[model samples]
Target: MELNQRKGKVMIEQTLEDALSEVYLQISPNILESFPKFRPPVDLYIYDQAVAQVKKFHRAEARLGTEKQAVVATFARENLLFLLRDDYRVYAEHLSRKLGLVLVEDDFKAREVSEIFFIAFRDRMDVFLSQPKIEPFKELLRDVSILAEYLWTDPCRVEFLTKTLHKEYDLSVHSVNTMFIGLGLFVMASGARPERMEVVNLALGLILHDLGMTNVPKFITDKTQYLVWRDRGSIENHINAGLKKLERLEINDPTVRQCMSQHHERLDGSGYPEGLRADSMSMAGRLCAVADSFSAIIGDRPYHSSKVFNEAAGTLIADKGRYEPALTRLLVGLLKEGFPGCVGEDMN
Candidate 1:
């Protein structure tokens, strides 16, 4: 079973001695005795099989291992030794070409935003949340301004949005979608060109809207059943905690502060942290409240399954006076147009 490098070519067969020498040289001594009948110049197919058999007992330890180690463990362990010779190189090259193709395809899809931007945003969020002082929050505001510039000028491509929605896990995904929804609403409502500072503030509020949840214990956050009264109270306080943290950070913009503080406030005075009614709510605060609530209804939550798009929309509409009716209608319309409902199966 000679393995040929060129497709469809035969591989050279080898004696047991030749196979043993090659095998021993390539593998560790601890694993060598397991295969005593090893032959040299053996068919590449048989060689691959032998290597595979040995690997079955020796698992690879690292996520990224050497090519030779990968080849031996993958193809060889499966007993396809005939692929060892030229076939191995050919297969490696084929895989390389395939990876290159995939990367090119991803580049085409990712033209609107770079991976670097997302990484930077995530890192900045971590720093903003962890900083014991106020300076980092200010720095975070600057970085977020740059991020907003990218979003406002270039805008995320449809594919970029789809990919991000699919790739992100729960909390991050919710945060990103809320930012997009809030920004869209701000654009529609303001009429004026979105000022860079306003966009940055909006982005910061959207991203950190749930930051206080970090204070909530995992047991409470992850409870699949309805939270008990005490737990429920704790959960409610997360909003207050978030506002206090922002206040400590010296975030002085009333719109920004209200966006964070009143996101949970209802028009009926039923909401938390003072529960100021609609007449007293700032427009920014109202928009954030609507966006945050709508996104949450459509998104999967700890104790509840995600509501269907229409159902979630109806709930928002039912809130009516509690939320701005016109804005609610626009959001429902956006949902109807098939932007993936904020929650449920992967968007793509």
Candidate 2:
């Protein structure tokens, strides 16, 4: 029985690849009336059963509100259903709703949703980085909007994501971590409920703040040794590089532009790219600075050892006049209050 259970787990793991290829769409309001004319663009499958037997009920043969439909809805409720990857926009509303549900649900369901969403989101970022096209950029914004909504609904997701964040540094993961941390900071700082668009734009800025780093060569970014002046110059150029990419993509959102431009800028005129002082920086810029710095410190990179929650937060606190103190203190509060037992867990 143990062997069979292991085999079942393996099989499920194997099938997850195919499952991730599908997405979720909103159920049509007038399914019976819209049939034949507005059929599912791709073959539809009840995702729960598809793992064992990849059977698909064709759009042509199946009725909209039959047993299969019921099964599909059930699978969706259970987080077992998905639609074709290419047809992601076909049912984008449905996809967002399902993701929202998973985000606020139990730990197990949230983790399951995060694993799937992270892979897909990372791949989406990779595509945009590689191609640097308009469509992919827009898709990335939409994905971040969904992410922002998750935070709006449950701010504690920051602590949850912090606990689960990969200790090793990867640009994509770092960007995501920054988004969660930065957005959480924003939520905390803004006592009154912020506008929906404000959160969405801020989330986009935080996640894509490192977009310019993609332009820098891997040798410099991954260097374990001390970076020489020339290497440092190239690294600093990522801001300009990122701005250029945004220009190409025609992204004109003020918050996003400010974040990418000012994430590297410091409060005391000690940072690069612009060397803007405290009064010169925007709130968005200051928040990104703290979030980006804290994320880098906690994640294990080639040149730096990883710090636990307390150590990382302490480092930020110690750095006088560099990062915004209010923001830094809010982060510390989040680490202590948001995460139960975390204060003692990494004390050693």
If scored against the real structure, what TM-score would every candidate get?
A: 0.58, 0.68
lDDT of 1 by residue, 1-79 (tens): 2333331112323464345434332322222212222221222233333232322222223232355445544434332
Most accurate candidate by lDDT: 2
Candidate 2: which stretches are off by over 4 Å? 1-117, 154-159, 339-348
What is the alpha-carbon RMSD of candidate 1 to the true structure?
13.5
Residue 123 error, candidate 2, Å? 2.9
Tens-place lDDT digits, model 2, residues 108-199: 22433444456546666778777778898878877766766765665544445544455768888788778767876887788645666898
Question: lDDT of model 1 at residue 250?
Answer: 74
Determine which window of 10 residues in candidate 1 has minimal summed lDDT. 100-109
